[model samples]
Target: MLVKELKKNGLQVELKVNIPAKDVTEKLNQSLIKISEDVEIEGFRKGKVPLDIVRQRFGQNALNETLDELVQSSTNEIIRDKKLKLAIKPKIDVKNFGEEKGLEYIMSLEVIPQFKTEDLKKVKLTKFVSEVDEDDYKKTLNTFSKVQQNFEKKDGKKVSVGDGVLLNLKPMYENEIVKEAQIENKMTIVGNKMMIPEIEEKIIGSKAGDKLNFVCKFPSNFPNKNIANKDVKVEIDILEVRVPKENTLDDNLAKSLGAKNLNDLKEKVKKQMQGELDNVSKMLIKKDLIDQLDKIHKISLPQGLVDYEFNNIWAKFNDDKSKGLIDDTDKNKNETVLKKEYKLIAERRVKVGLILAKIGEDNKIEVEESDLKKAIEEEIMRQPDAKDRIIKFYTENSQALASLKAPIFEQKVVDYILANIKIEEKKISKKELLKK
Candidate 1:
């Protein structure tokens, strides 16, 4: 066997490999003997087929299969012997293969990037701060108030927006009944088109005991794919009309939310809002920091890593489409455009990841067991069935749980950079701070 390096460019390497014809033939003969033992002819019992008969029946296919298996097994051995850290599967092109000639092939692969990270003190970042205002407090209070609102049946009046109406609704399209149900305590909201839009529109001019036959077209882009863009007629009998009664923000309302009093609830809501805003502010700062880092320390990323990142992003893109977040019509174009855009983002991520990984290694920023457990606990809290399932998942997939350590390492590196760099805090309005 002979090995020769053809090209070495950054992470990519091309190598020419050659094996002697004698050795190749010996392996092929061995494989043929194994196949002969496994296969049986009509005239012979099992494990007694002749090599000539086996070759005649299977023909060249057996040799090809044998060579394919040998190539894979040999490739693994060669890569292990060479000590190459392949980013993706190597591309193999068979240059020569014959009875007398040796097995010759060229293998191209991308290895891990080799570069020193930029100095921590060299990267500069700015952190933004936003103060909670009256508008924030008012919005939080309004949300709590809406949750505590009460409703009662109203009589001798037309149903309008914000009024909860009880009715029996039968929806039909082309004389075929699509949906039929006795809806009690159905809200007569004008904007919520998902729930009986046409009926609710007619209910505005209808009083209690009014039987309304509404001929209206369902929204062309309705969520229910089966009935979308179809003309539907709804038969609605308004049994009761109820108005929304605003409940006073008192001790009872607070107690419903597990709070002692209105003021205590308000304070809790404000604290929660502040914490959320602080996190958002931190995210904005992190983005700015990355942008600065990209501008300063730029490097060409390995194509294989970029492709892997692109696949991850594409999976998320399809997921968003399935969730009805993105329109089906825009799926193909959106995917293509996103692929290009995310390719750039993916390359940046790879660059940043490589840099952070090297930095962690150099600085000896090790991830402790406590740190991993805390991170796993945080993930578990995000899920509804946190206890058994999350623990089981982490226990089964050790490598997957270990991936959580990367983000922690990156965060520590970022923190180290922030501490060394000159980051002047900038106070801005909520509107201004949110703007890119």
Candidate 2:
């Protein structure tokens, strides 16, 4: 076997490789013999086929298999010998290959760029911290208890203020049906702020399968601009109704909500709300931290890596565009312009990922088995009835299992930096912390 450098650009390498004909023949013959051992020719025992006949029957297949094995081994050998850390899998362009002529191919690959880590002490980041107030806790508890509320069918009964009604809505402007604004199967508490006063009043004595047509004016600041501040013709089809079960927030209610008692329920509500807010805080700081790191580090990103990331972004963009799901701002931009702008986003994402990986490597941070176990446990808790299926999915799919490690490893790296780097915790109100 032999190797020679064809080209060496920034983080990209092209190498020419050749394998000796003698080694190729030896490997090809062995492959042929292995295949012959598995064949049972007519009037001949297995493993008893003559070499010439086996070669005649399987020479091409054996040669192709031999070349593939040789190419992979040669590629690995050169990668190891050159000490190249690949950003992606190498591509092989075979120039010439035959059992008699030996093998020749060009291996092309992008290597990870080398750079110095910026000093942590010089990088400053702020983490916003918020304390839950009594009012906020009470609001959260009320919201969660609503989630746990039980409702029973109000069969053959008239619609009431506190009843939940399943209905379809259609509104018209200038006597034209607003197809785009029509809503189906919207569940609403009759007198809730979301329901219009005139509409709710009309539905008061209506029973199941009843229809009502009326006109109502919406507020100027209505979320759906189709009917905002306008007197529009309205139609409602009441399908069913349910009345909420009245209960005090005591031990029975707490037990129904998977809590020990009323006090425990309050504590759980506050904790859950705080946990969710803390997650939001972490997310905000993480974006800022990545921006800070990006500003400090200068990396000449490999074009292949950039292209790979861009392709993923562009593919998703195209997919969303096809589904009419792209944001309003993105909708007006031309394809070429969107591609150019998104390419920069892809560049940033790739740079951030590489930096995080490098930090984790430098600090010897790793995702432990316990981390994966806890993650899997949390997933099972989310889909309690599918515990076995969830575990089996992770167990059988190596890619899915590996995907779980990426975020965990990244968060660990970020936490390490936050702990060691220059940082300050800014105390803020819950409302301030929640601001976008």
Candidate 3:
């Protein structure tokens, strides 16, 4: 057996391999011997077939088995000997194969790029710092208050902001009713931004039993492509209005939410808000680090890796299109345009992934079994009823276990880079931190 590197270019390699005819013959004969043990001829006892008879009967099968085993083993040996980290399985093409000629093949494959990571210490990044201020606390409390609000049926009352209304809505396009757009007993809250502004405004100030006719022009970026950017006539029948009762923050409210007292609830809310704000801050800093890394390092990406990622993205896009859940960015675009855009995204993702992996490798970072177990435990705690089932899943499913470990590994890598980089903490308002 002989292996020779034929070409090397930007994470891709081509190799030429040759196996000697004597080795091939030996392997073919060994396979034939194995086959003879299981063979039965009408004129002979089982497992007593002659070698030449077995070879004549199953010669092609033995040769094929030998060729497959030789190719696989030779490829594995070459990869291991060359220390190649393959991004995908190698493509093999048989160039020459005969009883007298032995075997010769070409193996082409994509590998992880061999490149040094940029100096983390030289990467400058800004970390936005924010805390849970009184206003943020008050805002969270207001959310809780809204969650606790009770609705009282208001017969004969006109619809108003903050009131829930049940209505039968029929949408018409071009003077024809859209059967799929007709909804009955649709409960919408006024000023909730659920309906278009114009339609919601028209619904308000209308009493029960009032039939309101209005036209709303759907936004061009609407999720549903059918009615997007089109003027639709809405015929609304206001069935009832429900007014919300004023909510007061008190001990009873706190107890209802599993808190001991109002003060305990407020403290929990502040802590939760602080944790959320910290996570947002961390995410911003991580993004900044990733962007910096992307700009500084110009490594060639593996095409196979990029294509794999793009296939996943494309599959999801097709699935969404089938469900009529296409996003505005892709709603009106042709498949070619969508593929072009998604391919760029896939390339960026693959590049970033490679960079992170390299960093993790350089820093000797790893995800421990304990870390995975803790993560699973935390997830199970979030849904205690499914604790047993979740445990069973993670234990049995290797893919699920990897999915759980991926984020943890990524975060650790980010943290390592963050520690090395010069991050300037810039104090910002909570609103600024929360901004998209």
Candidate 4:
């Protein structure tokens, strides 16, 4: 076989490969022998078929199969020999294949780029710190009080617009009503707008033994195909009046929430607030780190890698738009602009990933079995009756488990950098702290 480098441009390489006719004949002969041993003929004994007969029956097919296997194996062998870190699978196109000149093909692929990362110590980053105060504790206490409160049946009273009530409801659309259902004394706040906004408003002033009739028009984008953009009339039956009850935060209440006393509960609330603030600060700091990395790095991304990143970003953008999280004003913009902007993000991510990998390798940073086990246990504790499920999920998805290692690895890297860097604690107003 003869090999020639046809093209080399920006991580992309095209190569021309040619195999001798004798080599093709040898592979075809071997395949024919295998077929002859496997086939069952009427007059000939097993493994006794003549070479001429076997070649006459399946020669072309055998040659095709042999060539396919040879192309796949030889291309991979060539890539390994050349030590090319390919980003995607190589594409092969046969230019000429016959008995005389043998088989010739062209293969194209993208190889990984090489570049040195900037020194980590030279990078400057600030991690914001927000300490929980008395106000934050009081807010947490109020939230806990609401969670501990329960609803009870109220005596005879008129259900006003701002009142809460329990009721049963069944809505029907059009002349033909194929489905009917009932809600069993479900409590609904009258002015909370849980159901149809128009119907909820109409039921606000209803009293016991009073029947309210209202029609709600479903939006065009409603999920129910049959009822979408159509009018649905609902009859609501008021059962009982209900109100939210307030609870006092005492020793008993604190004990119920896994605390020793009111003081302990307050301390816990403060710690929780501090944790949330720390998480927000970390996110802000990470964003700044990426932005700075992108600004400083000057490496050019391969077209293939840029395309891959754009597809992911485009998918996420469309998903957010469908969920009403992104404005429709920017939906029809050019993808090239999006690609160019997001390419920086991709480059930063790639640079960070490579830096972390190098740090881990040079320092011999390893994720122990115990750490992975602890992480899995923490995940299991989050779900009800999900221990087996969590284990099964981790077992089935080695890639996800490997991703968990990245966070552990990155944290170690960051901790190392923070230990060596100069970070001074700064006290600021709550408003300024939150803005960070």
Candidate 5:
């Protein structure tokens, strides 16, 4: 193996790496063996396929894996040896690859800019401060009561609003029973428009055990196109109806919700609301602090990092636009204009990010596992209905976990800066504090 620096222009370093053919063949063989273990042949059982035969069937895939593993391992070794603090991920451009010719590639690296942190004590920032209003606290209490609602089977003859009705459904399309659309034991909230608005409306005022027959017209772009743009005959058998227990704001209700009493519940609600208000205020102050830091430090932003950020922003914008979610102002902008504006935004973001990172390095600030656990726990509290899904998403997706850590680290650094800087808190109304 050989490594040589091809170019060093500003923060960008281009390296040319070459691996000898003998090592390449060794790696290719190892990959073939690993892959062949699961491959089957006509005359052999699974996991007993011959290497040559596996190569004959899956050679290209094994070779591709070999190249990727060799390149990534070599790059990691180089990055570790050089103690490289990367601003953006390295780009690899293959020059040559073959069993006999070995492998060669150019790896372009973008290193983060190193800078000394300036004293932030002189930087003055206005911090917006507010508390949860009485009205808002009451509203939150009402929300909590709604969340704690207990549904009990109704003894009345007819289903009413806010009642959960268990029912079976059958849809007929074009004189054929739509078995795929049939459902049983589906508990739907009356007047909540389950599945279809018309179905819920027709089911209201109906008694349990009553059979309902109706026709529902679906839109052309409905998920199930077989029934889309057409009226389908439907039959429903109501199994049971349950109505929500009244939400009584009292000590017993608070006890049912795990609070000591009504006052404790209010106190907890106020504290939670206040914590949210503080987060909003902190975010506003952090932005202002970052803007000041950006102005104070005139480090030459790495072009590669700026370009990477710009591409990400552009990709997100295009994705949103493709979904018809672009605002009128951006929708009217020409591509050239949008690109120019996004480029500047990207440069600012990259510059600020580099500044925060340098500060963290200088201070040895680190994100602990506990911080991530707490963050995930908070997310579960906010989205209790999607708790399992949220946990699965972060636990399974490495990129998503990294994204979660990025913000946590950023906020920690910001908090450290705030502790040192001068902040003037101005009492503001909740409306002013929360204004977008």
Candidate 6:
């Protein structure tokens, strides 16, 4: 066995490997012996065929099988011996192979780029610090008030903005009633923009027990494909109208929400908001640190890795476009422009990912069992109703578990870097902190 580094580029390598003809013949013989045990000759019993006879009859077949196995094993051996961390599977091309001649092949792969990380102690980062204020508290309380609002039945009263209405709705298209378009006792809030503006406009000022007939043309980009861009006649029967009762942020309201009193509720809200602000602050700081590192340490990115990431991004973009769900970032760009933009993003991501991975490897940072368990528990807690299903999925799917572990490892790496970095806390107003 012999290995030679044929070409070396930044983060990419091509190697030439040669296996001696004696080794190839030895492997062929071993494979032939294994096959002889199962092969049957006309006069010989099963598992009793001689190796020479088996070779005479199945020489080409056995050699092909052995060559396939040898290629993979040899490539793996060379990779291991070279200590190469591949970004993607190596491309193997057999240059020469014969019974008398040695086996030779070329293996090309993109490896993790080699670079030195800047000293964390010398890295400077700005951490925005914000304290929850009265405005935030009041806004949160207002939201809670809306969440906890009560409704009082209105008898024979006309529908108005902010009033909730129950109705029976039937939609007809082309003089035929659409299937699954009939709903009973559906509750809708006026002025909430839940339905199209035209429908809401026609429903307003209608009293209970009134029947309204109207035709509405759905927008071209409406979510329901069946009704989108189509004009449909609608029959609405107003069952009842109810007005929301004035809500007050009092002790009873707080207690109903599992708090002892209003003060307790405010304290809880403050803590939750503060935690959210802290997370935002930490995220900004981490971004700054990564940005700094990306600027200071420059290395050529692997085209294969960039292409892989770009393909993934483009696939998702196309999927979103098919579903009529283009995000703000990609809303108006043409496909060619989008591809160019995303290619840059993919390259940056691959670069940062490689750097962070190297940092984690250098520091011996890893996601421990306890960390994984805690992450799984937190995920289960987030979806308490589907705890059993989530647990079953994580147990049965190793890839899903790795997906959960990746972020944990990345965060651990970030924390390790932050611990050694100099982060300057800059106090800012809550408004400024929340601004994009």
Most accurate candidate by TM-score: 2
Can you give the TM-score per candidate against the true fold? Answer: 0.70, 0.79, 0.71, 0.73, 0.65, 0.78
TM-score of candidate 6 against the unseen true structure: 0.78
Show model 5 residue runs off by greater than 4 Å.
25-66, 97-100, 131-277, 428-436
| Candidate 3 or 1, higher lDDT | 3
What local lDDT score does residue 33 receive in model 5, on the 0 to 100 scale?
Answer: 88
| Better structure of 4 and 5 per TM-score | 4
Cα lDDT tens digits for candidate 6, 179-291:
55566897888998887788889989998999999888867776668778899999999999999987788999999999999999988999999999898888788888878
Better of 2 and 6 by TM-score: 2
Is 1 or 5 the stronger prediction by lDDT?
5
C-alpha RMSD (angstroms) for model 6:
4.6
lDDT value, residue 63 of candidate 1: 68
- Which candidate has the highest lDDT of all? 3
Q: Identify the runs in model 4 with alpha carbons over 4 angstroms from their true place.
A: 6-10, 33-54, 98-102, 152-156, 161-186, 194-239, 251-268, 315-340, 343-430
Residue 146 alpha-carbon offset, candidate 4, angstroms: 2.4
Q: Count clashes in each candidate, considering only residues at least 3 apart in sequence or on different chains.
A: 0, 0, 0, 0, 0, 0
Candidate with more favorable, higher TM-score: 3 or 4: 4
Can you write out model 3's per-residue Cα lDDT over 189-279, one digit (the tens) per residue?
8987877787888888998899998788978776668888889889999998999977788998889889999999999999988899898
For residues 1-436, write the lDDT of model 2, one tens digit per residue: 7999999988889999999888888889889989999987887789999988888888888888998889988899998988989999999999988877889999999999998788877788888988778897877667665777667788898888888888898888888866645669977887776766777788888989999888877667766776688888889999988899755668888888889998898888889788988888999899889889999989989888899999998999888989989999998899889988999999998998899999999989999999999999999999999999999999999999999999999899999998887778898988898884
Displacement of the residue 349 alpha carbon in candidate 1, Å = 3.9
Model 6 pairs whose backbones collide: none
What clash count does candidate 6 reach?
Answer: 0
Error of 4 at 161 (Å): 4.3
**Candidate 1, pairs of clashing residues:** none
Model 1: runs farther than 4 Å from truth? 9-12, 33-37, 43-45, 48-59, 98-100, 155-158, 168-198, 209-238, 255-268, 298-300, 303-347, 360-429
Work out how many backbone clashes candidate 1 has: 0
Output the lDDT of residue 244, model 2: 95
Per-residue lDDT of 213-331 in model 5, one digit per residue for the tens? 98988667666777777898999999888888778889999999889999999898899889999989888987789889988888978898788899999999999999999888897
State each model's CA lDDT, in order: 0.77, 0.86, 0.88, 0.75, 0.87, 0.87
